[model samples]
Target: MASQEKIKLVLLACGSFNPITNMHLRMFELARDHLEDTGRYKVVKGIISPVGDGYKKKGLVEACHRLEMARLATESSEWITVDDWESQQPEWVETAKVVRHHHAEVLSSENNSNGDDVDTGKYRKRRKMEKKSPSCMNPKADRPHLNLLCGADVLESFGVPNLWKPEDIEEIVGRYGVTCITRCGSDAEKFINQSDVLYKHRKNISVVREWVTNEISATHVRRALRRGQSVRYLLPDSVVRYIQDHSLYSAESEQKNAGVILAPLQRYSKTE
Candidate 1:
């Protein structure tokens, strides 16, 4: 039986999403099923936040295209929505900040639903002085919990040197928690056990094993697209059509843009 009062939760996935793949969308469903099965949490929303062009990673496409592809991929889902806040930013925002921003938005929405005016100043002050548990809000309250949804690879990236701040890890895992959707052959649990911070907050991390393994990734999709191979089912039809229409990831386009550094504004334009 379901709990009488289940904690409301929102799932946030932040990434390059160069071209959002089917696996990226399936992660939300896997996490929702895993969490709701526990009878303690109900996933209320799923948000996909694509990184801005400032990340400057290899094989990363324009933020606008990635944002649009994400929106198109999730347009049919009732619970999933695309947030452009991170993508529209002038530079890449930290993952912890993005999660916190979404949490505040959730709290603001809950307040608005009850006809209460959100006092921004008071909220900021409270957050600054918060010394309690990870979640600054009362667990018994009706507020929704915002958890970061990520793949096992990202979870392991916590060990990458200088890639993530220790404090940011605490803020994200301690405050909001994480719902990691792990694929087959991944050693997600082993990684968690090896980290001191992750081990300390182990309860806050929930790992959902994806039984029906899928290895579809954006890098592979881009490669196939560049070589003129079929990617009909690897991604949504709408997204595939969008890529074709804009000639994205084509050999010509890739060669033309290869090794060329573009400014933030220049990176937002679609491929010719």
Candidate 2:
């Protein structure tokens, strides 16, 4: 029997990433393991997209810092990378829009890599030259699919009043699909059953249960930093150094942004 072809997919984790933590990086591995275990999907890449400053969430640091910290955290990961597009936006963009943009980006990259644009119009000539080459496979066969990666809290947040739009949810879950990593208390199944949209497109959603409980929360990390406590093991050493060098999340930093109105979006929470 011939080996089954897997769907090429990229996992996109969008969050505030106020300070990328160990658990944040682990989520990608957990999701990849679960997806590959099924032998149906191949996770070729993982992207961390930090929310822009326009999100207005309390304790949320500057986009530059968040983006750089995310980069520093994922530096050692071969397939994991940080994208600053979302954080570079002038305003808070919806999750669905972010997903759509990235999907297009992946497709564009795949096209370029597949020799679709070889020398502008010389693709035909190149194809003719390599007509007998076994490596010249159809690009569509390996077209990359982008999926939103999130915690169960984000799946449940679909029900939060006015926090997320219904159409956006449909586009995200229905179109690009979602890989929700289950947290201890988050009932991902219950939330899916409660929402008609999610239930309608349930097949596209993959609920990945994280067996090893990692309770590393950026919120708590911030609190520890503010209180001058140790957050060594909770976050990456480079990220910790970056935070210390920049004085981020300190009591003084908190005081400077004291008037920042906390939005319903919880920072570094399970939702992120």
Best by TM-score: 1
Q: Estimate each model's TM-score.
A: 0.88, 0.86
Which runs in model 2 stand beyond 4 Å of their true positions? Answer: 1-4, 118-142, 255-272
lDDT per residue, candidate 1, 1-272, as tens digits? 34647888999999989899999999999999999999888889999999987776667778889999999999899999999999888876788889989988887887778776677776556545543544524566456788899999999989875667788898888888888988666789999999999998888899999889999988889899988899999999999999999889866544544565543324324321
lDDT of 2 by residue, 1-272 (tens): 12347778899999988789999999999999998888777889999999988888767789999998998998899999999998998878888889878876786687788868645656555445433421213323445677899999888988986677677897788767899999988999998998899999898889999888998988899999988899998999999999889888976655544676444344324354
lDDT of 1: 0.84
Give the distance in Å from residue 12's predicted Cα in candidate 1 to where it truly belongs: 0.2
Candidate 2 clashing pairs, residues 3+ apart or interchain: none
lDDT value, residue 53 of candidate 1: 74
